[model samples]
Target chain A: MTQPLTAGVSLKPQHYADALACRAEGLWFEAHPENYMAAGGPRLAWLDAIARDKPISLHGVGLSLAADEAPDEDHLAALKRLVDRYQPALVSEHLAWSMRRGVYAPDLLPFPRTQAALARIADNVDRMQEVLGRRVLIENPSLYLPLEGHDLGEVAFLAALSRRTGCGLLVDVNNVFVSAHNLGFSAEAYLDALPAEAVGEIHLAGHAPDANADLLIDTHGAPVAEAVWRLYGRLIARIGQRPTLIERDDDIPAFQDLMAERERAHALLTRETVDA
Target chain B: MPDGFHDRFLAAVGGDEAALAPWCAGPAASAGLAVYRNTTAKGAADALAAQFPTVERVVGPAWLAAAAVAHAADHPPRTASLLTYGEAFGGWLTTFPPAADMPFLADLARLDWLWTGAHLAADAPPLEATALARLTPESFARYRLVLHPATRFAGFDDGAPSLWQALQPPGDPPADLELGDAPEGLVFVRPGLDIDHRVIGAGTLAFLAGCGAGESLAAAAMDALAAEPGLDLSTVFAGLVAAGAFTELRTLS
Candidate 1:
């Protein structure tokens, strides 16, 4: 908590020693809490070492908050245990749902944003916050299919959810670009519309063209694309400044390669301080 | 009946491609649905590959992925924390027609699963090397040697343990996937960060089993000798002690 986190890279096990040894200012690490839910292991010990020097963010991917039912109590308890142990600088989950009917799909599966759906998700978020005794940021999901029967737009729905539950947003800039291209909307317009106050964290990751379709998949396998970087720049300019993360889940490169990208975000985030 | 949008979309992603028509229109519909389906399958496949590395290495990536996709249909992940997913995969493999030819695969999978259990089991300090040395023969009969929280062991009808150990690095590739007729077992002990695994003898397996069942040292030793009369009890117990297998002695109050 001594140095404000300007930007961070997603922590991978391979880079644990480097992450711990690095002296970069504001270089925190984000991790999927699901990966560290084990009772005991070297993974937890590694996190403890790195987190001692740098901030750690427990960005959960499996809470399934948008599911119709209350978020799974056991998942919430596991999350609570992590929150208590790490005291993470920020915690977040997606606006999408993956668990349904006792079956959990791995992807951030979408749901029709209806008025009823809104109520269910709000309650789910409430339960998550209540159980953890903290407010969590909800990241927007990248849309693939355009579903009918939505009661609100993505921005409006998120805004409403924030108003109702006092949660924040972890906007993944690449998701905006990909969703807008697939759903036939303006990426810039979507960024402009997000309530600046609700913006708590930002994510930048790579995407690839779907082999069989006219869609961009959030592969996180490659480096951040040019267009997404532009969107991230525009978003931070509007929202002033927030903790940003560079996520590379698959096809990870060397620690130095990711730090180069992290430095880009960090430089942009800091320049705003001088300008303002 | 499928209840609503959540239910219907899940069904579409679950394969009823026609169900995608209601949510999306035209060619884009199928393509979008395909993306979801592929992503879902890839997620499960990737987790499975990591969970059962030896299986993947033996059967090849393509075959393992095929099996993972098929197994997921009936036993889709019940939880999103996938580190421990595929709990039933070992048993499920027995019923998988493809695995009928490779009869040893089920036991291999079970061995792989035990490795994961030991990897994530709770941490605890091992018993002092000489905790049993000072015990009176009379007192030893009433006391138990407690297994460490991170200790795991399993017996196999075939040589699955030896096969798995062969698949580990520094060791050459195994000769074949053929199951040896001789019965074997494996034991895992994590003294520190690194886990130590060894192909255990039948007597050692029986001794650990008795300890796991909460039997006294004297009783377990009897079973160990019974299982393998030639098992040098002193040397075997000392070897287990050196491996950091037991946490403490459960003494009578």
Candidate 2:
């Protein structure tokens, strides 16, 4: 039976033991496949132990689906190996591109949302899904630079990509909020525009204010801000409940502290489901 | 001009201010561009820090972070798997003027790189002592043993391995790291979950090196003896076996 989707925390190496021992109802764990792409090691061992009891989501940060090229075959093979081994509850990549030629930037880079770019990314997503033999989720990237050549709004672009590729969306609410604030848009309208049925998972992560400018960088280094929480409540209320994850990549707190935030998300999700 | 958004954005991040003007509405867009540049720099720097903890310990975090950022610009990662990202860093440090005064720094970086390899190597059940004991004396000389995928070792002209071993424990590194005259051999292995290393002798180093090259047991022992005349081969061989260094054994036809 598929495990009931509920609020989960991003599994860090430090919190593996706690993650294994915790018996929170509907608690799941998410990790970046990039970190676990090893031939063998203690990290894989830890993930093995954790996945034995918990449902894992293999969220990838480096697939570079939006690159003006196909996904790397070796990278796809590695991801396939992990999927075959772990059988994660969901697999996800971002709408951003990180690799160009042979050099990788190690960040979720932006590109113009033009029709040609859309067709290329859709084709890339189709190849990724075909290679994995499963419908993967493509996430919306947080924008920083105000590029002028976008042919469609972020929501419309994502919706069109999902429609064409038959891939699900992993809506990062924090990313939506950050992108909206930085680019002068409405987070509410952006979330409203997404096809609710296409969203398989929702992500809530922390962002920090940029030091030099009035910009909110998606740093994932702090507790989820109140504004983002309000947006999360709104998104869950509209899209119904999905597998919401509280992602804290940098400056991770104690497992219990993170679980507290996760519990808040769980409570909200349960309340929304019950209300529905 | 419209299709050049990606190339222009990349160039702008690479520090070409004019490349982004085609995409940007005004000067205010530079702030957003700076955010991307800073985040990319941080990601590369953080990965380098994780891969080279010993280097970070020796040079201090701030200095190493700055150096990592600079190193990343010259040799950006070619893949998203940052685990294998800093392969060129040790060689790069050899030419870095700041690290030139510390002649041992490059070798130290190389040791750290090997340590990472050991840490991430494939998992396997180590060969048991009983497996080695079952080999007949007649066939022992003709047999070849496979080193564990996690096994890595290197020899240095000076005692850099000793200094590296001392700095392995997390604390304030010793104020003075003396380079002894005697050469040192370092062996890294992950027989289990955690990676461990030990100082070895020149003879053992040559034996392991020969074994890695698929030499017969007799040839490996000969190389060991040749490297260190009058060496006690039994002690070194038994120690490595006990360390879980070899994973498989087969007889050569």
Candidate 3:
């Protein structure tokens, strides 16, 4: 089996065989646990075979930690099954809620960082940890519209969640760039202010410029921007090194292209570790 | 905090133009919220469309996308992970206005949903021929074969199954494939990381349905033959076994 992932790529069904045959060092894969949440089938079988040969991470997009309540029990149970089966090196979910009143909107939605919201999310995270029998990494989401009723900054809220639920942070530098630009904040300062020691992983993905508005959308469809790459370097320099991922969700290039991006991250992490 | 953050965030996401004006300044606010809303809805629709490609192909991407979006808005995913989302979409389409003309659309949607289920099913070993060889005719009468975890079959009152089969590889002009005016049957199973499917007849459907409902093998076969004489029982049984349908066997009390 491969070592715990140092640099990884999101596993797509279209590239399943390529992912299985890939030979990059310390190369790993991450998948949305929801995709494998089924009774019996080829998707689960493929994941089983891949997990036997590599370190996998279950990157969840649907736990809805920021929702008004805890995750659906069935969803949590399904997640637990994947974790148990794969023995993934990392398990992560976003700090956004997409399900409420039994209605799910398939995105990492934003919410005000109020004390109430923080407490509720922290409780939700705690429940997740308790059920999964392990700690998880909570990711920061890309924000579009800012709302009122805030009592904490994104970094501060993440730090509070880490402290309360023993969860770590998966900092998506691209999200920081996108949200910072849209909401008018310094992406550099946002990254710098993050509790670097609590950060367990990093995400780098592409974004698109909104046609109708002066905003950047986190489309994850293109190459990582130079600005985000530069910020990633700076974050790695400060935090030493973490398991970084190069995410390409849509208009996916070939596996080799993603591996090239992953190699860049691996090189950066290697340099930072050696320097440290 | 002017009001509850969750409530305000919901208001902002639901397109309350001014409630989030402070959060989103100026003319860009509505556009920005619309972007989020569109992305969220599109993400759900895209996953559904991918899961149900044959249905999308039948309905056309543009028309299906619109239907998927409206279907999603009413019965949004219950979990943040969209992999297992859209359980209600097939049923929802039966009542959708635009889909009314395509009355068989619901069955097609159900087939797509089953395909998704088969694709994501757990791994299981196919029943070995040796295991079957060990069974005597008397034992077979007492034994009920358990279907694989990934096995799914349906009996349709019309030709929807045949149309779906035509969409499979090696079949030509699935679009031109006519839905015959007779009840059809289908069976889907994944043997080794690939989903395999087949179109069967009335006897086979009755047999599988009887097996699914916990009937013993002999009883199911009797039921199948009763439904349609000359069903080539041995051949059909062997075909199902080869397709990785049965995973276990149990003796009925």
**Candidate 2 clashing pairs, residues 3+ apart or interchain:** none
lDDT of candidate 3 over B1-253, digit per residue (tens): 4544455555776777667665555666686778877887788778888877878777778888898888876877666566677678888988899989888778888888888877777678888767888778777688998888788899898988888877755544454647789998889988777788888889998888888889999999999999899889989988998898888878788
TM-scores for every candidate against the unseen true structure: 0.97, 0.98, 0.93
Which candidate achieves the best TM-score against the true structure? 2
lDDT of candidate 3 over A6-65, digit per residue (tens): 789989988889999988888889898988877766677688888888889899988889
Point out the higher-scoring one by lDDT: 1 or 2. 2
- TM-score of candidate 1 against the unseen true structure: 0.97
User: What is residue A256's positional error in candidate 2, in angstroms?
Assistant: 1.3
Which DockQ value does candidate 3 get? 0.61
Docking class of 2: medium
State which candidate has the highest lDDT: 2
- Per-residue CA lDDT of model 2 for A26-85, tens digit only, reads 999999998888999899999999999899999999999998888999999999999999
Q: Residue by residue across B113-224, what tens digits does model 1's lDDT show?
A: 9889888888888988777777776776889999998899988887888888888767666676556778898999987778889998899999999999999888999999
| Model 1 lDDT on a 0 to 1 scale | 0.89
Candidate 3 scores a chain A TM-score of 0.98
lDDT of 1 at A91: 95
Give one digit per residue, the lDDT tens place, for model 2 in B1-253: 4566667778988888687776784656888888889989999999999999889888988888898998998999988889888999999999889998888888888999999898889998776777878676567687988899999999999999998988887666888977777999999978888888899889999999999999998889899999999999888988888888889887877
